[model samples]
Target: MVLKTFGWSFAVTALGLVAAVLYGGWTAFGIVAILSVLEISLSFDNAVVNAGILKKMNAFWQKIFLTIGILIAVFGMRLVFPVLIVAVSAQLGPIEAVELALNDKDRYEELVTDAHPSIAAFGGMFLLMIFLDFIFTDREIKWLAWLERPLAKLGKVDMLSVCIALIVLLGTAMTFAVNAHQHGGGHANKAETVMLSGIAGLITYLIVGGLSSYFENKLEEKEEREHEEEEQARKSGKKVTAMAVGGKAAFFMFLYLEVLDASFSFDGVIGAFAITNDIVLMALGLGIGAMYVRSITVYLVRQGTLDDYVYLEHGAHYAIGALAIILLITIQYQIHELITGLIGVALIGWSFVSSVRRNRELAAQEALGEKAESHS
Candidate 1:
């Protein structure tokens, strides 16, 4: 099972490392290795969340995710997306941005870092919406019942998640404005930039998430209708076909996954510069890590890990929430990537332990009931 799941990831890692070593020797290889580890550490929650979505997809769509989706994650987000951000933010052409990245990495890094506020605002708000929606939805299983219960009740209020997200954006924007005012410089443009970026992020989430949910609901309804027909057909001694997610639903879910990956990658891309500004090494390293994440997602789906450890999904969402808040906080203050990665790992680990305990408790109860039945 391990080899089946991780074979492709391992292959990619070997090839990527070989290319890195050939390009810049051992130093490049080492940087690539570190970057790969960094990406995986930062994106473990991403894999978990992805598993929850990908399981609903059919085999064909799942293969597409592994193949085409990996390409987009590696080249689109890790490579081209950053450059696009630099080009638009610095008012330069795409070629100029790429040239800046290749020839003047320091300037490139500066431009990227300078654009952090807006990036943070956009990605932060998008992730915050995701976290908000997850916590607000009523679910039978609640990891943090004390908090989730209240949130679920409050979720009944119309657009509560959007409202809260907007309020957060407003508060952060105001804080930025206040800081700029106190500094008494021409830095107030940052406040406006952050405000606009946050709104854009929120809107992007609404459009993408809303469409995905709509199509998913339609798929479920169609499944239910077909299931009824299949039952009737079975009663008539006819063979019933298996059900899979429809094309439209799968496409939207795939789009949602890509956007979610982008939001998760924002921090990693920016944080990677702290280690190395070489985009090639970063892509190679992060690309290898992306493959592992995809592999892990597939493994989780195949193993039914999420179903076994019910609270794992909750933990992943909570980690995403924490990461979202951290991104927003880093707009003004510097946060180490180690701290970011640790928070996610710690939450996931704790949830896994909790799941084991819950399982034991459930087993003990079942054993007691069986004993009573046997006695009777």
Candidate 2:
């Protein structure tokens, strides 16, 4: 059972370990181990969010996520993506960027670090959209009833999330942009760059989100039509439980997941530089962490954990919101990874406890009712 469920994760980790040991000796192995743990600790909430989406996809797509998708997450995001960022931002060719990373680690790190403000802005805005949309939308059940109720009411306003996110981005940019100018030292363009980066992020969220939503809706409609036809053809009434949304629908969902993963990786990649300038070490460490997260995602789906813990989704989104805010703040300041990881884990831990308490209450009520029925 363990192998069937977590085999891919184990395989990926083994490969990553071999690669790490081959490329770097025992000392590098230790650093990779530490970084892997750091990433996993920081991204537990990310795994929850991923499971929420992954469960909605078809089984074929789910397998793809584990197999082909893992390759993208590990190599594409953890490795090539960083090099691409440096190449674009530093105006160097890909070969030169790789060369610089291998030859001049400090300079490469500086180039990556220099781009932090924009990276933070883009990722913050994108993730902020995800959080705001979730909280503001109408839901029959409320997690934090007192807090969520008012937010739901506010959701009546057209595009409330978009407006609020834009206002926050502009406000932060204006405030910090000025501070960055004086203290930032030769970084007078920080404000403009931050604003532009935020806008870019907002645009990315809308485009990707809009496309995914459109495809999902169309797939739903197609399924509904097929169900109706099948019911009509049957002499007796029946319902269709599964859907066959295979091609375009799957592609859009795949796109959405990749983008979401990229957004999550931005913080990790930036923070990894703080620990090590060795690109190979960072990739190997984070790649192992990525595999475990994906395994946890599949486990959550198969176990139906989301259904069991109703408020867990709320907690994950709240964590994402907190991370988004942290990213925005880090635009002008350097926040330690430990602090960032702690904040996310704390919120999720509280939510899990709340879910357990609620479950026990429900169970006790059922037991009491069953006892009364037996007596009657």
Candidate 3:
């Protein structure tokens, strides 16, 4: 099962490293390898979150995600997205942006860095909305009962999550973004750009997430109705057909996953500049890491890991919330990539440990109940 899931990732890693060496010798190879590790560490939470969504998707859609989706993630987000940002921010034509990326990487990196405020704002707000919606929603399983219970109660208020997200966006734009613009020697419209970008993010979240949820719920309802019909037919000795969610639902979920991936990649794309300005190497490295993330998601779903470790999704969402706050904070201050990676790992690790303990307690309770029954 492990090889079936991760075979391609391993092969790609091997070939990518050889290509990296051919491109720039061992030094390039080392940098690419380091960047790959960095991407994986920073994005481990992303794999967990992705697993939660991907589990609901059918096999065909999952294949599309692993194949075509990887291409978009590697090229579209890692390469083209950064260039597009530079082009828009620096007022360069698309061709000129690509030329700059290929010829004068320093200037390219500078423009990308200059554009960080907007990038951070947009990605941060989008991620913030995700975290808020997740935390606000009521679910049967509660990883942090003390916190989640009250939050769920509060979630009864209409649009509470959206309202909170907007308020936080405004607060950050006025204070942190403003200070960043002035103190960082940015243009007069820096804070305004941040504000607009954040609004764009929020709106994007609403449209994409809303549509995705709508279709997913529809699919679930369809499945449920079909399941009921199947059960009735079975009881009556009638033929029962299989349940399948249609392609349209999968398509929207695919769109949502791509957007979610792009939001997660914002920090990594920017942070790669701190390591190296070689965009080719960044694509190769980040792409390798992305493949591994996909593999992990598949493994989780196939193994029923999420079902057993109930709190993993909660941990991933909390990590995402932390990452969103960190992205917003980065509008004014620089944070180490290590710190970001560590926080996510720590949260997930704690959750896994807690899940194990919970399972053990459940076993003990069941054992006690059985022994009592025997005595009686």
> Cα miss at 93, model 3 (Å)?
2.1
Model 3: lDDT of residue 91: 96
lDDT order, best first, reads 1, 3, 2
The regions of model 2 sitting more than 4 angstroms off are 180-189, 221-245
For model 2, residues 286-358, the per-residue Cα lDDT tens digits are 9999888888888888898988988888899999999999988887677899998898889888888899999
- Per-model tally of clashing residue pairs: 0, 0, 0
Residue pairs clashing, model 1? none
Please state the error at residue 81 of candidate 2 in Å: 1.5
Q: For model 3, what is the alpha-carbon lDDT of residue 97?
A: 91
lDDT accuracy of residue 274 in candidate 2:
72
lDDT of 1 by residue, 1-376 (tens): 9999999999999999999999899999999999999999999999999999998889999999988999999999999988887899889999999998888877787778778888989999999999999999999998889999999999999999999999999998877633432111224347888899999999999999999989888777678898899999999999886676748889999999999999999999988888988878888888898899899999999998999999999999999999999888777777899999999989998888889889999999999999999999
Q: Residue 33's C-alpha lDDT in candidate 1?
A: 95
- Model 3 misplacement above 4 A: 181-189, 227-244
The lowest-lDDT stretch of 10 consecutive residues in candidate 3 is 180-189
